[model samples]
Target chain A: MTGPKPLSNLMEQFQKLPGIGRKTAERLAFHILKADIKDVARFAESLRDVKEKVSLCSVCGSLTELDPCAICSDPERNKGVICVVEEPHDVFAVERIGEFTGVYHVLMGVLSPLDGVGPEELRIGELVARVEKGGVDEVIVATNPNVEGEATGMYIAKILGGKNTLVTRIARGLPMGGDLEYADEVTLSKAIIGRLKM
Target chain B: MPLYESPAVVLRSMKLGDTDKIITFFTLYYGKLKAVAKGTTKPKSRFAGRVEPFVYCNMIAFGKEKADLLRLNSCDIIEPFGLVRGDFEKLKHAFVSAELVDICQKERDTNMEGFELLLAMWRRLSVEGDARKQDLLLRLFELKYMSTIGFHPFLKSCVDCGGDIIGPKAGFNAIKGGVVCHKCITSDPAASRVFVGSVKLMGKSLEMPFEKLDRLKADPGLQGDIDKIVAGFVKYHIRRNMRSERFLAL
Candidate 1:
């Protein structure tokens, strides 16, 4: 624990980050110490910039430096088809796939009532409002395939049921390349239930 | 290391660190306990679907001598209860049951009756198609759960004066933990009016077997009365509003 106050303070901050332990924090601090002053300044500046610049998009709720975010502002992307995800990071996950050319709506979180997360706590109302604004054709709920996620998708469907827009949940099944023998019963059942006609 | 294994229902889970989950389970043997499932956040982790809330599984966990949180070793699902989880209304009702157990039971306290009652409720919820029946079942589960934890509201006689609750003038007092006759209604200004029929319906629901629950009937008005009485009683006893209760209106 004995160290220069500044070094210790840097380590403490590193330890606050997800997955960083005391040893890792110490190593990171020492690495910063050994690095060039300019490099460290750039690193620190980038960190500060991230905090200062990143805010949720006004339209989609995804973390972005811009108000509407690039996807929301994009002329080519289909705003009519909105992909609803649980977190801003999820937007990146879908974006990585590069197949979907639709806009996104980040729920920011799932509906977990036991943890005291309810509809009001999430971005569900915003999603409904976006759908109600009129040109939207379909909403593809891409929440995780967990109980809370499934329930959230259902809740969204119910709220949007009367709207002219179509509400659909992403299909869940065995992973590609996953062996049927190793698949759990629930996954197997879901695969069967959601099976496609060959 | 002592390995504890039991059939348990996942009450809830919370994110731990970057990849781990702290899962609370209401086990048939252990009653209620929490364990950390390592690396469960990863998409392909073995615990992916197993650690989710409302999953019923045969869980194996190991504990240190003094540490309260056990390390979850493995789990095999007994029932995923996916049918209930897939329906928003049913899911809300199921979460209410799970939350009630989490709030009322203490860690590592074994209560077989309570555990069985919860399982029965989930089983009923997963298969029962009628929405009204589902509501009735949830109310019954709440009542049964309250009694299992020793908070059973006195519905038969007056909670205040031990007098017979004879007429429509009776009121259910949440503060006093039971029904009050017309004379004792003044004791608690907040007590809501309780019809004799609603009181009798709750009593019968408590005593009746799970299979025969459908045989008991209450019109929409009576159902509403029981709902209010149970909600108030539970709110007063639990000391905090359930998060899931709000979403039930949706």
Candidate 2:
């Protein structure tokens, strides 16, 4: 049997990345193949550096070269209102809106029983313990507006049900099944404002 | 060990460790459940193609109580939602619909009605054409889902005063939950006033069924009026604006 060409192998690898399909992967692979050596080297090095240097923030799960993410360390952010999301990418999504003046806790994933993801598989217990220790007044369930996301938010709400902290779900203005990263500034801003206590 | 069976729709499936596969399904009796279909990834496995996304199946699984995963015993495909996979727009609409059910319904709690609503919409998407009609159908589904979950926006009469003063031309109070009469809006200390045209649009939306909604249309000017009313009220109450809706406008 003949092995795939180097270009074909590169396209296959690129396809493994989320949101990249076979056609898009081929385009991306060709683009990389045509790029200058320096540009390609920069791209490759950045990927390596991200793995080698980036670590999860001690307080939140956001990736950072520092122990605490920039937001976690900043004194200006409202530490009292923690905006909890499911993944590190969501941290960026919330930041782009520019409305929330709070820190975050990335659960790493929502509860997906089919994939064997449960509370222990996520950063949920740590979040609860963080709230239990006090000072935090609100926990915003900003998980992706999808099934696993809602369940994860609900489970968090139930676990933190009686705690002194107020629990709320991020308003669903972002569309029923859409990803948070795609929401416009106006909608994201309004969702933050319209968040109702759960 | 606890054993149970439920009517489920496969939302997604993927290979697991060697010879096994992990399948995620939304069920009628148990909400959402995951099972390890051991050896199902192999070429000779019985579960091949039967457990993939959009297949409506009756599943039987058993495992220790409180454990996250169950052992798969059987999966019988009742409906594949096959018609949707053939068309691009239909597939997109189906994915969005499945995603809605996946995100909205609670886990471990049976939302049989929601499960049905989702399946019905999937069936409709498979056969329906017009893009505008598809959008409205999804909106109707959203409204129904929101209502089932108890977030139903009050459409008829004042939510605060309980008066029969429905907005004939248009009027609404997003803050007050639904439509408020002109008198109540002007007098109430807490009410937020909204356009009368917007209120009428919302009234029509909440009152109409999904299949029939596609047939109902207004003049271009009136259509804009209706869209704004339904959208504003939805945005105010649901609290999150959808990106697809924004895409639709563009």
The top-ranked prediction according to DockQ is 1
Highest TM-score, which number?
1
**What is the TM-score of each predicted model, taking all chains together?**
0.95, 0.48
- Per-residue lDDT tens digits for candidate 2, residues A88-183, read 988998899899998999999876544446677799889998999999999999985434565577678878989989998877554566566644
Per-candidate total of colliding backbone pairs:
0, 14
Report the lDDT tens digits of candidate 2 across residue range B87-198: 4456555655565555556667677777877787777787788766676566667666667667777877777677776444434555665766776776665554555654
Supply candidate 2's per-residue lDDT for B196.
60
Candidate 1 local lDDT, B32-66, one digit each (tens): 98999998877567787788888899999999855
Each prediction's whole-model lDDT (CA): 0.87, 0.71
- Per-residue error for B145 in candidate 2, Å, reads 1.4
Candidate 1 deviant stretches above 4 angstroms: B186-190
Candidate 2 chain B: 10-residue stretch with minimal lDDT: B241-250
Error of 1 at A198 (Å): 3.0
